[model samples]
Target: MTAIDILGIDIAKNVFQLHGADRRGRPVFKRRVMRDQLLGVLSGIEPCTIAIEACTGAFCWARKFEELGHRVKIVSPQYVKPFVRGQKNDGNDAEAICTAVRQPHIPLVPKRTKEQQDIQALHRARQRLVNHRTATICQIRGLLLDRGIAFGKSITKARRMVPDILSDMNNELSEMARDAIAELWDLFCNLDRRIISFDKKIEAVFRASPTCQRIAKIKGVGPKTATAIVAAIGDGREFRDGRHLAAWLGLVPRQHSSGDKRVMLSISKRGSQHLRTLLVHGARAVVRTAPNKDDQMNVWVNDLRERRGFNRATVAVANKNARIIRAVLRTGEPYRAAI
Candidate 1:
């Protein structure tokens, strides 16, 4: 095994592009390795700094290389984008990642643990099921409305009212439409079961995870929110402060400034959409029962509601909650609601 430095990997499902450079930033080794042979291939080489774009399945390989006595860093794909030369290809991307890694201050991604990935898988499944359920609900609504039947805004309400509406032989509805609703109802039921199963699995995970247990103390955070935040940010110490964490989560307002003028736009809409959604939803839930909430957040939200409308108020509270989450996680401190 020859010594090497700054090895970059462009990962795919089957084929992986590897670019190894010498100590002075000159290209030395270039080859493609099959997916199954990666560990053996890396094991054959001497330890050095490894760089790879942060994408799906990259964390596992990072862990593997770390075990192989190499320093591995995952570069954000967005940060690597500018480094790509005129044309984009696996080799170019690998080289770009290599170049990006040499910078001492490049922001690195937090690697997820196996347990964090498990929680993420649950979230992915639940999101899929929710999408399917919504589609089924929309179909039922459209079909029923075509036959002049009305329903409330929610799928659960549609599921409940459909049976009774179809139970009686109403002349307004045809047999074909009734059968369609029945099929749609069955589909909705299946999706509902899947969502409930996901809830149970996530709830069980929350119960068993000590880290998640501690995070759940934040007023707006629940089992899902806590687990998602834990998985997304890992230890949260990587961030310099809660403000940076909030910016990473894209909850902070976007800024554009000039010599004498400054403009603020909407949030960046980057980072984990699911995490942002969970935080916002949890914040709204807390705001719904604001008087009962015993924290500075409750007071803030209450004051905002009197000034801003409900929608803006919800997002404002969520942004604050994101900051609180980061601070708590970074300090390893439990949430102590401010009076």
Candidate 2:
């Protein structure tokens, strides 16, 4: 018996509608299943390709479906939205998903493992705390500056200055406002400590992974970027080459073509914005100190800097670094400074 080639699912928090087709491309099944019953139902079905939109809980469900002896593929919602037929309902969406899945070059999102989810959670929490701390400090500085006391712009100096600024008895702050300030200050301290702990934890993981160490050796690759890349691309076999890796990170140019006249602009900035930011920032750091190093990469960076100022050069370097990362991860090759 031939196996099913395409199956579309419209997923929801409580209920799901599944649309399945037989191997000959004829509609064979259309049914609604409760969330709890979904796995049991899928488990009984023979191994077949499953298609879904990449949305909340989709990845987790994909993992579960894969465990149940089915192949799962997730497509970007934007691409699937066009196929949505009249009246936007679960059945229509599922049918759209089926249509989208059959496109020859449908881009499939990689399914993340449980470990990747955990590490990503840590990264998200750390980022939120860092943002909160920044906002808290800004509020403190603004309140103090209202009374003629201003903090230095540097975060390090601000950290130390906050205590002395708040402890001043001469300040006109009301007792209630002062207490609130104190509480905020304490919260900032706690956020800082927790951030540091997470930093250490991430570093420990980075150092322990041979793949992470290989990536870290490359210039401009830091703990967050390295770990994210490692987690996102567990095995490089998923990508054909470095360019594909860069494209996945949305490093390639955007395309707008009509009647043979085409234009390409800045990077698409479509996927993994955080990862892209990390790579670009790290590239800036490398560009700033390129003169101190003597290597082909250094020369290349310097040449780019001379031709296209530092900012664009940084982006170029970051793009290249992203490619290098893909190569190293895919081939298990250690990084080497260019000749």
Candidate 3:
């Protein structure tokens, strides 16, 4: 066997496809192996640079390969797509990964620790619960509206009206309808409890992580955003600079330029949607409250709001915050409020 320098594995639940190349990038071997025999096969081969797409179970496999003395690189699926040739299959995908890994400029996905995955899972759970709660509220409102009962947009208002409508027999609601609404109300409360529980868990994580604490010191960053950013990109080493971080979060404007003619559209809105949303929401809150403060950040925010309008200003602030967060993570320094 030629001395394999790079090996790419296209991983799946039950089967694995591998493509190997020599130091000169010539294909050495391509084969398929059962999941159970994967480790045994790799253990026999000389230790080499292994590349895999960053997907489910990728990190675990990367850690395993690293322990076996192989240098592992987890490449983003998008980055590997361009290298794939011919029909798409496990074998072709593996080959593409092998090719992508050898490219000097191809950005590799950072290997996440188990702790970071756990924190990310918690955030995902909380987001699901929140969506369920919103759906429940909308369902309740729609049910009441059918009976000619209307309430304010606020969830609290809808909740308050539910009890009143159930108690008053004067309304058009049937007993069965009342029972159904009551059940939904109960569900809403349960979701609230679960979301609160997730929040507490996130808070505990924030309390325990000094990195989270340092990031949270920024004006627009709270416990949730702080923990999430840390979990998503630890130490900010993957990014070249703060602007790159902002670009990763899709906060920067999208460009469609050719030659000297330049055109820019809205934000690219790529990358982590959850982090982008939290940062934008936090920025919105800061903008709403900035009028009352005289701090340097607030003054700048207010001026931007007046010049760019509120919505544009909000996104601008979010972009700024993302850069600040990246800087703080890279430097391991706490944020200092501008006077």
Q: Highest TM-score: which candidate? A: 3
Residue-level lDDT of model 1, residues 100-157, one tens digit each, is: 8888778888888887888898998899899989988898888888878888987668
RMSD of model 1, in Å?
Answer: 2.0
What is the per-residue lDDT of model 3 for residues 230-292, given as tens digits with 9 covering 90 to 100? 889988898998888888889999999999999999999988999999999999999999999
- In model 2, the runs with Cα more than 4 Å from the true position are 1-3, 171-174, 257-262
Q: Encode model 2's per-residue lDDT on 232-336: one tens digit a residue.
A: 768666677888888888888889888889997878987888789889999999999998877888998999899989988988888899889988877887998
Q: Model 3 compared with the native: what TM-score?
A: 0.97
- lDDT of residue 277 for candidate 2: 87
TM-score against truth, every candidate = 0.93, 0.93, 0.97
List pairs with backbone clashes in candidate 3: none
Q: lDDT score of model 2? A: 0.85
lDDT of 1 at 137: 89
Whole-model lDDT values for every prediction:
0.85, 0.85, 0.92
